[model samples]
Target chain A: MQTIGKLSAATGVKVPTIRYYEQVGLLPQPARTQGNQRLYDRRAVQRLSFIRHARDLGFPLDAVRELLGLADDPDRSCAAADAIARRQLHEVNARIQRLNALRDELERMLRHCACGTISECRVIEVLGSHAHCQGGHIEGADLAGD
Target chain B: MQTIGKLSAATGVKVPTIRYYEQVGLLPQPARTQGNQRLYDRRAVQRLSFIRHARDLGFPLDAVRELLGLADDPDRSCAAADAIARRQLHEVNARIQRLNALRDELERMLRHCACGTISECRVIEVLGSHAHCQGGHIEGADLAGD
Candidate 1:
């Protein structure tokens, strides 16, 4: 068993993030030490490792939670897991497309810039006037956020 | 002049987001009708469009503010706007690189799965073992808070 801070060091996960995982129930409630500090066992280590890997790969917390559920049900078909992965792939592909469009727009805006004043700034001009917009940019944080 | 809701509809921006822009001082405080409803001018429309377009190109709100300030300043050199664009381009490139890394990792993890139970699930196993990870696959929204 190790203290939460020690576990955080070993896992390379931030202390607050670990606490967040615990708050979200992704990590089981760890036992407390005599001094009231959180103590983690090997299982906690494993869970943190899983969370870290998932996060590193860009799985949102909610998706990670669903993945953990699917992972816990060993007897379940791999179809669900496969589905989740495919969904993530789709999302990633869409983002790449969007970002590519943005890259092009930024490029064009930058390329034509005369470097005079904002009135002569191509970047600001494109953004300020949608008259020439080709319908590719929508910059909300998440398309699927509820 | 359009009300906030109408402006939201016209721009495809959300109601709360419009209010958020107002709160953050991106949009000037609008005139109020006797009913206290916000009223916007064509200039406000232009400003919001500029803000939204900059945002879609992945410019941070702070960067957007700088660009807006540049637009407002007729005497300021367009170099400031160009600088902001260049900065955003760099950010976009960095994000693309990170997403590519994440995608590679996700692909590897998915490829390694043996279609077994959760006890032997390669997806879970991959996530639970950090040593095997190279990293990719994060949502853009999560990328922002970091």
Candidate 2:
């Protein structure tokens, strides 16, 4: 059995995050030592490592929860896992499209600015009046766009 | 002047969302009619349109506020407006990079899956053990060969 601190060291996940995972039920509660401290095993560490990787991949907590559930059931079809990954891919692609639009608009506006003094800058004109925008990349709510 | 419904119709923004914008101060409060109905004018309509378009471009409310300020004062330095746009651009590009990483992983996992029985599915194998992932798009958590 490994202490919480050791689990943290092995998995490179923060102790608080591990605790939060347990609180949220992402991780199962571990056994307690004689000193009343939590004791984890190698499997727990492996699971923690998996959770950390999925989060780093930008999988939302809800999606990660689903993935974890699927992982725990060895007899389950992998199609479900594929489906989740596909959903994530769809989201990522949609975000890419929106960001690409934003990129184009920003570049066009910046190019027009020519770094003129703030008073007469093109950036202000673009932001101030959409009528002047000749239909360039200006777009949707940032968060929703993603 | 128009009623809230009319304003919603004109801007194509949902009534609750309009109210939310108003509550958040994105849209200024309009004069109320004797019957307590909110009334808006042509300028309000125009402002709403601008707000919608800026939002479409993924500008945050805070940045939109600054943009509105710049738009109102033509003489203000356009640099700030440009800076905000650039900042948004940077953010969008960063997201694109992350999304690409996710895309690569998902695509590879899906490809490697041979529709094998659940016990031997490549998809499950990839997700169950990040160790199966060769290099390239690594999790931000750095559990590379461990």
Candidate 3:
């Protein structure tokens, strides 16, 4: 058995986050010692490593939860896992496209700035005029959700 | 003078978000009528529109605040604005690079899955082995901050 700190070292997830995962049901509650400290078995280490890997790859928590459920049942088909990965890939691609568009606009603004006073600053001019923008508002709130 | 609802209509920013901008000091507290309703001038309309446009382009609130400050001082040099845009572009480029790497790994995993059982699943195998990843851990927490 390992303490929470040991588990964090083993999995590279912080101790508080490990407890949070348990609270959120992403991780199974572990057995406790007589002093009421969390004690995790080898299985907990493997499970947490999996969660960390998935999160590092930018899978949303819901997708991570689904992936974990699929992972737990060894006899299950891998179709669900494939689908989740594909959906994540699609979202990543969409974000990339949006970011590229934003980069283009920013680049244009910077290039046209002329390093002049703010009144003549093309950056401010472009930002102040909707006509100069390419279509589609990339909502800040949508980025927040991701 | 325009009502908050009219400002929302004019700028494509919602009523609550305009109020939020006010609360956050992004938008100035406008004058009020005898009925205590907010009253905005043409200048407010332009400023709110600028904020909305900058936000739609994925400028973080701090960068947006700086850009607004630079805009407010018409005689100030535009170097700060240029720097902010350049920094934002660099961030966007980094995100694109990371997402591309993630896409490559996810694509490879999906291709190699073979529709097999979970135990034989390439998706699980790839996730379980850090060697299978390209490089660097992109924490979901970092994405939240952006």
Which candidate number maximizes lDDT?
3
Per-residue lDDT for B28 in model 1?
Answer: 83
Candidate 3, after superposition: displacement of residue B131 in Å? 3.4
CA-only RMSD, every prediction: 3.0, 4.3, 2.0
lDDT, candidate 1, equals: 0.76
Docking class of 3: medium
TM values, all candidates:
0.89, 0.84, 0.93
> Who is ahead in lDDT, 2 or 3?
3
> Would you list the clashing residue pairs of candidate 1?
A58-B137, A58-B138, A74-B118, B101-B136, B102-B136, B102-B137
Model 1 in CAPRI terms: which quality? medium
lDDT of candidate model 2 versus the reference: 0.75
| Model 3 lDDT tens row, B1-146 | 98999989988899999999999999989999999999999999999889988887788888999999998899999888888889988987777777777777778878888988998888987777677765644544355434
Off by over 4 Å in 1: A134-146, B134-142
Ranking by DockQ: 3, 1, 2
- lDDT of all predictions, in order shown? 0.76, 0.75, 0.84
Could you give candidate 2's per-residue lDDT for residues A13-124 as a string of tens digits? 8899899999999999999988899999989987887787777666778888998887778787878877877887787676666567677877887887876566777766
Per-residue lDDT tens digits for candidate 1, residues A1-146, read 99988998888888998998889899988999788889999988877877776776667788889888887787887767766776776676666667767777777788888988777778778878766556665556352311
Worst 10 residues of 1 chain A by lDDT: A137-146
What does candidate 2's lDDT look like per residue over B1-146, in tens digits?
Answer: 89989988877787898889899998899999998889999988877876776676677788888887777776666677888888877876776676677778878877888765567677666766668776546556321110
Per-residue C-alpha lDDT of model 3 across residues A1-146, encoded as one tens digit per residue: 99999999988899999999999999998999999999999999988988988887888888999998988888999988889999998987787777777878888778877998889999888888888766644654355434
Which wins on DockQ, candidate 2 or candidate 3? Answer: 3
User: What ranges in model 3 sit over 4 Å off?
Assistant: A134-141, B136-141
